[model samples]
Target: MHVLVTGAARGIGAAVVAACRAKQHRVTACDIDASALAGVYAEREGVDCVALDVADAGSWDSVLAEVWARQPVDALINVAGVLRAGVTGELDPADVALQLNVNVRGVIYGTDAAARLMRGRGSGHIVNIGSTSCLFAVPGNGVYSASKHAVRGFTIAAAGDLRSHGLNVSLVCPGAVKTDMLEQQRGDDRAALTFEGKRALDASEVADVIVDHVLVKKPLETYLPGGDQWKGKLCTVLPEVFLSSVEKSREKGIRNFKSPQH
Candidate 1:
């Protein structure tokens, strides 16, 4: 199988590349930062590094053309995304737009492009990387959560649209993973205060699910450590109680965060 993975230079994307390779799948690792990709896969066999800005439709064309010229992609993993954290009263429109551009629009375009190629081939897979934010709202980082919500909706619609065409679209929603993006969230007080010092699943663990379960045995959606998503759902059932507990937990966590000894 030949796979093209966006955001492949680092974090979950880079880890997925390794997971795919471990299974002996031919992979084209792509990212906007070509240098970062080169650093990892310089002259590596069976792995192609290509520069792609998933937000740009034209860039998708060029990269897909390049990919098609070499190997008709068997799976397109949409992983490129951004997050901007702030509460509603203090929202930055620019940050929101940037996150929407990369996270929401990028996945939409990537899925469309992959569909075109796969529909003609008669069979293919479209795997999207979503977040636990798709299940519940993150207090400080509402925009990021909103974008993931859009991702979940779009993926479900995509599955319906492509079902008759022999294309399988699946969504993998993972809880906060230990990645650069997670670290960045820690830098913002509004968000970090809510989720700081929380150890998360490893990127490779999520990638393994992508390779082993999603691409191999396609499920409409698989939430990593499924219990996390169930917990998220339970919050929606009783928002007042859930939020009150969350606030109490947050206050406790903050106190512990500020003074380690006591």
Candidate 2:
């Protein structure tokens, strides 16, 4: 399968590129950081690199055109995202907009481009990388969580729109993966709610499943390590009980692990 991955410079995106290449799929690795991608995959087999800012719709259009000129794209994994961990009043307006633009606008633009390029073509997939925060509102990351929540909403609606026509759209919600992004959150006291009781997820473990599902079979939604999907659903139906459970977990994690010195 031919695959296009955004946010391919590092972490989960880079891991997905490696997994796809391991499977011998023709892969286009894209990121806002072109130099970082070149440093990692310049000599790698079955991989081509492209620079992209996923927040820009035009960037998606231009790149998709270039990619289609060579061969039809079989899958697009929207992994480019940003996060800011702060108390609600402490966040800057710009930070909030960046999160919404990258997390929500990027996915919508990518989905539209995929539809334009691959719609009704009998086989194509759009997989979005979302967060477990999509399931519940974490204290330090209000707008970031809202942005992920928007991605989840868009995925379900887009899947319903495209699934009958042989195109698939899905969202993968992951717990905190050990990455630079997670590192940024560690300094924020409010984010203890997030780090509470959760082990860092491996990027490859998350990436490999993405490759498997997008190419082999497609589900409307998937949560890494299993059961997160149910957890998100329960949050809606049982809001108070759900929140109490999260608070309990946070307290337990605090008791067991001391916060690292900054």
Candidate 3:
């Protein structure tokens, strides 16, 4: 299979690329940081490193055109995203736009572009990297949560629409992962909820599920750690009842953030 993964320079995206290559699948690794992408995968056979800004429609067009010219992409994983932590009342307009553009719009653009080509091919898979935040509200990362909610909603609808075209769309929602993104949230009290997870997931752990399971089974939605799904669902259905627990989790997260072990 030929796979294209955005945000392939680091974190879960990079892990996915490595996992795919380990399976001997052809991969096109894309990232906004072209230099870093090239440094990471340029010398590796069976991996094509491309510079991509997922928020820009034109960039998507160009990247897909070049990729298709070489080989048909069998799977597209939309892993490119951004998060800006701010409470609702003090939110920065720039942060809101950046999060929405990169997280929500980026996923939409990639999914649309890939689905168009896949529709013509008569079969393909689209996997979107979502967040646990989509299931409930995160006080500090409201915009990021909203963006992920948009992704989850859009992925589900897109799965329904693309099924008739013989294409599959899947959304993977994971809790806190030990990545640069999580590290960025460590010091911010507003981002305390993000650290509530007992332990952060390794990027490879999530990638294993994507490549070993999601790509093979093509499930419409999957939650990393499995337990998080039920927790998120319960919170969603009865947020008022869970308010106290949420506060407790936030307190725990703050402690986790401050601990050297975290």
Which stretch of 10 consecutive residues in model 2 shows the poorest summed lDDT? 253-262
The models' CA-based lDDT, in order, is 0.85, 0.83, 0.92
Write model 1 residue lDDT over 1-262, tens digit each, in one string: 9999999999999999999999999999999999999999998888999999999998998889889988899999999988877889888889989999999999999999889888997899999999888877777778998899899999999999999999999999987677888767653556643353244678999999999989989999899778867777787677776667766655654554344221
- Which stretches in model 3 have alpha-carbon errors above 4 Å? 258-261
RMSD of candidates 1 onward, in order = 2.8, 2.4, 1.1
Clashing pairs in 3: none
Q: Specify the highest-TM-score model's number.
A: 3
Residue pairs in collision within model 2 = none
Which has the better lDDT: candidate 1, or candidate 3? 3
Ranking by TM-score: 3, 2, 1
Query: Each model's TM-score, in the order given?
Result: 0.92, 0.93, 0.97
Ranking by lDDT: 3, 1, 2
Error of 2 at 99 (Å): 0.5
